[model samples]
Target: MIRFENVSVTYDGAAEATVQGVDFEVPEGELVLLVGPSGVGKSTVLGAVSGLVPHFTGGTLRGRVTVAGRDTRTHKPRELADVVGTVGQDPLSHFVTDTVEDELAYGMESLGLAPDVMRRRVEETLDLLGLADLRDRPISTLSGGQQQRVAIGSVLTPHPRVLVLDEPTSALDPAAAEEVLAVLQRLVHDLGTTVLMAEHRLERVVQYADQVALLPSPGAAPVLGTPADIMAVSPVYPPVVDLGRLAGWAPLPLTVRDARRRAGDLRERLGGQDGTPEVSVVTTAPPQPEAPPTSRLRLRRKARSAPTTAPPAEVHALAVRRERVQALRHVDLTVAPGETIALMGRNGAGKSTLLSALVGLVEPAAGSVRVGGAVPHRTAPPELVRRVGLVPQEPRDLLYADTVAAECAAADRDAGAAPGTCRALVTELLPGVTDDIHPRDLSEGQRLALALAVVLAARPPLLLLDEPTRGLDYAAKARLVAVLRGLAAQGHAIVLATHDVELAAELVHRVVLLADGEVIADGPTADVVVASPSFAPQVTKILAPQKWLTVAQVREALA
Candidate 1:
């Protein structure tokens, strides 16, 4: 029901079109997934469907885009609201009301639907998305994942024929992401709703797509095919696909069940004589003395040995209360220098709150938090900068400067580092970001890189990141993994709260699982994740009864 005929879009600013010669069509009642690396104009394609391209974003539309027989060029977003629903990358920008229930109903009200119909749809969406309990909660008070659900629910209540979504599950936990994807499936299968979604987390959404559209690189025309076909040749793919390619399977598998079915022989090849897969061991030495402070942050690969220094961060029976909710309770943890930990759980499991407590963003109701041997909440900002730094879930929270250049300069000043130190980090992490561009104009992934660079400039002994890979693609994520691994080798303690299980599988040395504000599972990465059904990566699931955590491990073993 959506068609793009020779579509090309160029913003008002400078050079060429962001997307060129893009032509595709979505059959009625089908879900099409748009896949590509970061900064490939996937968002631009999605925006075009909902009439946000040139209409609201001030770009030039070279070709025609029609949805359900309505031309987006002639029909502005407001005029096409009846038939199209759009959800952008950031959920906070979508809300127009205070409470969850109100936000869900706002779209229906805008369409002038009858009060009874609106109420019915609102209740249905709330139940579908599992937001019934959060109906009365303020949007600002909800967690990032919760806000994302509300944003999706708001668009869904209108019952639009065509849905355009950008990273619908980026902020959601695994189970929550499944629920959202299932909802989209039902909408397409049972109700004849058409969906066009662009997402970086292909592991969560690729298998569910009816067809796939791949934008190979920046300003490249899209190529369309079946999920399996596209994944076979696409530069970006999930772990299961990587495993399939490694094992030389005839057809690549998209789902765990399919991969598991084809994994019998491969499993035998990698299995030990006892019929169990050989376990991979990761060891770190006891803490050593603290290293001398450096002039500026630099990426260097040191030996993967833990230092014998004192722990950089210590949390003892930490209890944190936000408003009336006890966000965290009786949590005790320690991070030795040159160690990396992944804090993971479902939404509102207190992972973010725990990070906040470490950074002194939230005060503990009971117990204590220490970073670099100093009480976090009691330390001054200037002193704290040298001890700990946090890149929050909302990367924009740490960004305040008008331009990229100004932000880097400010980071250097705040961190007491050499000039251009932060700029160098930004260049390494996210290349091609000009100094003149505003932080607000950067893509979600670009903004995140800048925020991380700003924090890394200080070279704090303890580093904390929340959902670090939210918008990063595979290449960018690889760069991040390398950079973080280098930091850990340099005696920096890194703890990241994330829902990206693949990231946990590939980067972290340890996995700490939290639930209901309490630590439930804490151990080595392979030990913790391989044991959990919900948290296991695709490779682990496919090669079950085996201890494999990543495709790279499997590749190394086979080689």
Candidate 2:
């Protein structure tokens, strides 16, 4: 359905091509996953299919590109709208209307579909994506995941033959991500629609792909094959693949079920292992005396031996209302010095709200939020820097300067740090990025690194990061883990609101699960994740009942 022949894309002033010799084909009714390291041109390749690379993005495209037999070289994006639907990473950029229902119908109206057909498709999409209840809601008021669904449904209403999606599930929760993937699966099976998606969260989509295309690096040829064949050698892969490799399983499994089927012996080998290690810090709240004996024993054993007079930060009965919605309700949390905590939940569960409250972006209606003994909302901006710092979900929101060097300089000035502190942090977090490049021109991961560097410059006592791994590849994510770990070890309390379960399993000491607007569960990482099937990492699912939550844990046990 889509074909790229000897395709190469060179931007306006770049010395080398962003993508070169990229040849791939997606058959009718199939889902092709485009994956590579950050800045390896996966997005460039996906854009070429819809005639956006050279036409809309101001780049030079060489060689033939066709979608549904229409040559992209001759057709612009608008001309191919009926045959192609492209949803970029930023959902807010895709919306042209204020309300959900209007956004859903806008594409159909533009396509000039019959009134009855348009109405039918609108209703069908609303029901398919569980957006019926939100039809009258303003697009800006919806959560990030809700906006993502609306963006997808807007395009699907037009009934395009090909769908090109970039990081479709990055903002979605586990259930919502599954729902979106299921919708894609149905489109491929029931409607014979072809999909080309570039996503960084491979663990959510790798098992659903019909074909895997690996772009090793920029200007290099793509390697295409079945999922297993590509995953065996691909640098970027899901945790299940890592577990399979660690266990020496032949023909690495793509899904948890397949790995679970072959994990009986490995489970036996790790039979007596106690994978849940003790936490390094104590909670500010007193333990419940009425708890069960086993639970109490476990908590006592896992609790730190050293006592702390006060945590670095604390949230007490927090309640936040945004517009008409209560984004958070009676939420209580504590961040101890030298601790790493992961805040996890479904979409619209108030994780972002909590982070905002901690960072003083949102004021609590009822309860208090204190960072380093001062209420965050009442603290002054200049003083807040030394108390707490946050790396927001949309990394670009924290960036305003034109160039990377300027942004770093601004960060240094704002934080009162050494002249080159931010730049040095950027070098440590994300190496090899040219200083002169515009922050807007950098890939999503690079932009995120810049934002993180800006936040870390202050060296705050408490750190809050929301979805920090959104666009990061495995290597970048590893570097991030190490950085965050080092910060925690240096008396900086870290809290990350993320949907990346693998990250939570591998990096965090504790997991805090939120639902609706309340804290539902909070415990050790292994205990919290292993209990929830939807939130468990792939390795944990495969090694169920063994209490092993990550490949590193399994590797340690095996050794």
* CA lDDT scores, all candidates in order: 0.86, 0.84
The predictions' CA RMSDs to the true structure, in order, are 4.0, 7.3
Q: Estimate each model's TM-score.
A: 0.94, 0.93
Evaluate residue 114 in candidate 2 and report its C-alpha lDDT on the 0 to 100 scale: 95
Which candidate wins on lDDT? Answer: 1
What digit string (tens of lDDT, one per residue) describes model 1 on residues 20-123?
Answer: 98999999999999999888899999999999888988979998999999999999999899999999999999988999999999998888899999999999
Cand. 1 Cα-lDDT: 0.86
Across 1-559, the per-residue lDDT of candidate 2 in tens digits comes to 9999999999987888999998889999999999999889888898898888789889789999999899999999999999999998878889989999999999999988899998999999998988998899999888888899999999999999999999999888899899989999999999999999999888889988989999998789999999999999999988889888888989999888899899888877886344342333434433211111110100111111222235667999999999989899999987777778999998889998898888788888999998777677786564555566778777888888888999988777666568998899899878878788888888878898999988787666678888898888888999999988887766778899998898898898899999989999999887899899889988878877767777877777678
Pick out the ten consecutive residues of candidate 2 with the lowest summed lDDT. Answer: 291-300
TM-score: which candidate is best? 1
Off by over 4 Å in 1: 273-282, 285-310
